[model samples]
Target: MNATDRTPADLLRSALAADPARPLVTFYDDATGERVELSVATFANWVAKTANLLQGDLAAEPGDRLALLLPAHWQSAVWLLACSSVGVVAEVQGDPAAADLVVSGPGTLEAARACRGERVALALRPLGGRFPQAPEGFADYAVEVPSQGDRFAPFAPVDPDAPALAVDGVELTSAQLVARAREDAAALGLAAGSRLLTGRTYGSWEGLSTGLFAPLAAGGSVVLCRHLGQLGEEGLAKRVESERVTNSAV
Candidate 1:
C-alpha cells in the first residue's frame, strides 16, 4: 500500500505492521481433515525464521537458485516468501540439478538427490512436523527451523529489481512480481478484508498471482485447500459456508 512495498517481503511487512491479527492464510487438507490458520504476524514469524535458516545455516546469498519441489501447501508458501525475503530465486517445479539448493517433499527424494548442492526435505506432515528420521543427505526443515532466530534481517540488502521467482519458463523480478500481483488483485476483485477460497493446485503464474501475491498485495486473506477432490460437492459447500468465503477460484 506504500510506495516502498514493491516486493513480496515489503508487502508482508506492511500487512504485519498494519494489522498483525488479521488472518493472512488459512490452509486445509480435505483428505486429512487438517486445518491451520495463520495471522499476519504468525506468517511473518515463519518467514523470518525460514529466512534466517536460509541465510545463516544454508549460507544462501542473493541470486542463489533454490529448486522447490513441493506441492501446493502451507509450507511451500512459507518457502516462497522466505526466498523473496532473502532475495533468493524460488524455482518452483524447476530442475533440481541446476540449482544451488533443492527442497523436496516426500515423493521427490530421488530428484532432490541429483542436485549437487545443499538439500532440505520437508515431511509435509500435520503441523509442519519433521520426518520420523532425517532423510539421508538432506536437512530436515522441521528439525532446523525451530532453533533459528525468531527475527531476520538480510545480511545484504534485497534488490527489488533482482529476479526472485522462476517456474514453467517464467522468470520475474521482485518488482515485476509485485506489479503483476497488484493488477491481478484488481482483476480478481480482491480488496481489504476479502476472504478468498482457492484450490492449492495452481499454475506457476496463478500460484503467485491469485494464490499468494494478489491476496497479500490487496490486503485480503486466502483459504487454500489441498486434495480438494476429496471434498465432495456437499463437503465443499459446507466449508464455504463455515469459512464465509467471499470469493472462490477452484
Candidate 2:
C-alpha cells in the first residue's frame, strides 16, 4: 500500500482500479441463510450512492458526527465508507443524542428514535429490501439510497487530517485510520489477493481492522460472517473449501 492512501474510500478506489471484477466483500448470515457478494466496482457503486444520500439529501457536512447503531452487516460497512467519502465523522455505536445523523439496524428503533437529528433505518432483509413500513421519524435507507446519484462528489474537499472515526473513546483522522489499517494488514497476515474470512460482530477498531480495512488496504478481500455460532465446524470447513478462503481469523 502507498503511504499516500488517506481514507478507507481510497483503498476501495485502488482495488477497483486494480481489479474491478475481483470480489471485495462477500457477506453471509448463518442464521438467515443469506449470502451476498460484491465486486470492487459494485461496492464502490454502493458507496457512491450512499455518500450522495448523506451529503446531498441529508446535507451532512464534514466533521459532522454520524452515530452508526449497526452490526457488522454489509450495509453497515457501506455506511462507514460513505461517511468517509463525504468527510463526516463515523462513530460506531455512539450516543445518538449527540450525533448529527443516526443510522440504525432492524432492532434499534428505540435508539433511533432517541436521535433528534436525521435518521435512517435499515431493514437488513435479504437483498437489502426496504422496511415494510417507514419507521416513525426515520427514512428507509434501502429506498432512499438507490435513488441518489451513482457518483458522489463532496461539496468541499475533505481534509485527510480531520477526525474521521470515533469508537470507545478513541478518535482517529482519515490519514491515521489508513495508516493504522496498513499496520493491521501486516499483523493479520493479509496479502494481496488473499481471501480472508472473519466474523462480523466486531464493535470497534479490532473488528473493523481485520474484517474490512485490513483486506482492503492489502488489496485482498473479505468474507464477513454473521451469526457465526449457527455454523458447525464441518459446515465452516466446507464453506472454506467452497469459497477458497485463503485465510481465516474467526
Candidate 3:
C-alpha cells in the first residue's frame, strides 16, 4: 500500500485502484431488506457524480454552507465526499436554514422546517426507493436533478487553507485537516489496512478528524457510526474483535 500526503479525493482514487473490488461500505438497507456493499469504485463514482451535481445543480458557492440532515445511510457518504470535493462548508448537526436549502431524510423535514421558518429554500429527498421516505413539496434528489453525466462538471479549485467545515465557531481547512491527520497517523504508527476507530463520540472535532481524514491519509479503513445509539457496548466489542480494529486513535 503506497502512502503519501494527498487530498481526500486523491486518496480515495488511489485506494480504489488498490482494491477496486473490495467493499468500502457494507450495511443492511431496510428498503432492500438485504445487505448492500458499495465497492470502492462504485462509491467513488457516486462521489464524483454528486460533486458534479453540487457544482452544477445547486451551483453552490464556495464558502457557502450545505446542511446534510441525512441518516447514516448511503447518501450520507455521497454528501460528505461531495462537500469536500467542491470545497463547500458542511455545518454538521445544524439546520439548512443557514444554508440555501436542506438535503435531508423525510422524517427530518419537519425539524428542518422549524429551523428554517420560511427562509430555507428546499427540503430535498430521494424520489424513488424503499430507502428513505419522501414527504410533500420534497424535491427528489434522484429524478429532479439532471443526469450525473449531464450535470458533471470539474471540481473547482479551492484554497486549501480556506474553511472546509465550520465546527464550533472555528473553521477547519482541508489543508490543515490533511496535515493534522498525516502527522497524527505517523505519530501513532498507523499502517496500511489498519482498521482505525474513533475514540471520541460523533460530532466532536476529534471524532470528525480521526474518523474521516486519518484513515484516508494513512491508507487505513474507517468504521463510521450513525450515533452513539448505533453501536451499543456489545456491538462495539464485537466489531472491534471481528473487524480486528487497531484503535490507533485511542
The model with the greatest lDDT is 1
lDDT of each: 0.90, 0.89, 0.60
Flag regions of model 1 displaced more than 4 Å. 200-202
Clashes of each: 0, 0, 0
lDDT of 1 by residue, 1-250 (tens): 6667988999999998889999998999888899999999999999999999999999999999999999878888899999999999999988899999999999999999989999999999999999999999999999999999889999899999999998789999999999998998888899899888888464478865667888999899999998888998999999999988888888
Q: After superposition, which runs of candidate 3 have C-alpha atoms over 4 Å from their true positions? A: 1-6, 26-36, 71-74, 114-133, 142-147, 150-155, 187-189, 198-201, 227-235, 248-250
Cα displacement (angstroms), candidate 3, residue 91, comes to 1.6
Q: Which residue pairs clash in candidate 2? A: none
Q: Write model 2 residue lDDT over 1-250, tens digit each, in one string.
A: 5557788888877888889999989999999899999998898999999999999889899999999999988888899899999999999999999999999997887987878889999999988999899888899999998788888888998899999999778899999999998898888788999899998565878888777888999999999999887999999999999889998888
Q: What TM-score would candidate 2 get against the native?
A: 0.98
Instruction: Quote the RMSD, in angstroms, for model 1.
Output: 1.0
What local lDDT score does residue 223 receive in model 1, on the 0 to 100 scale? 92
C-alpha RMSD by candidate, in order: 1.0, 1.0, 4.7
lDDT over C-alpha atoms for residue 230 of model 3: 49
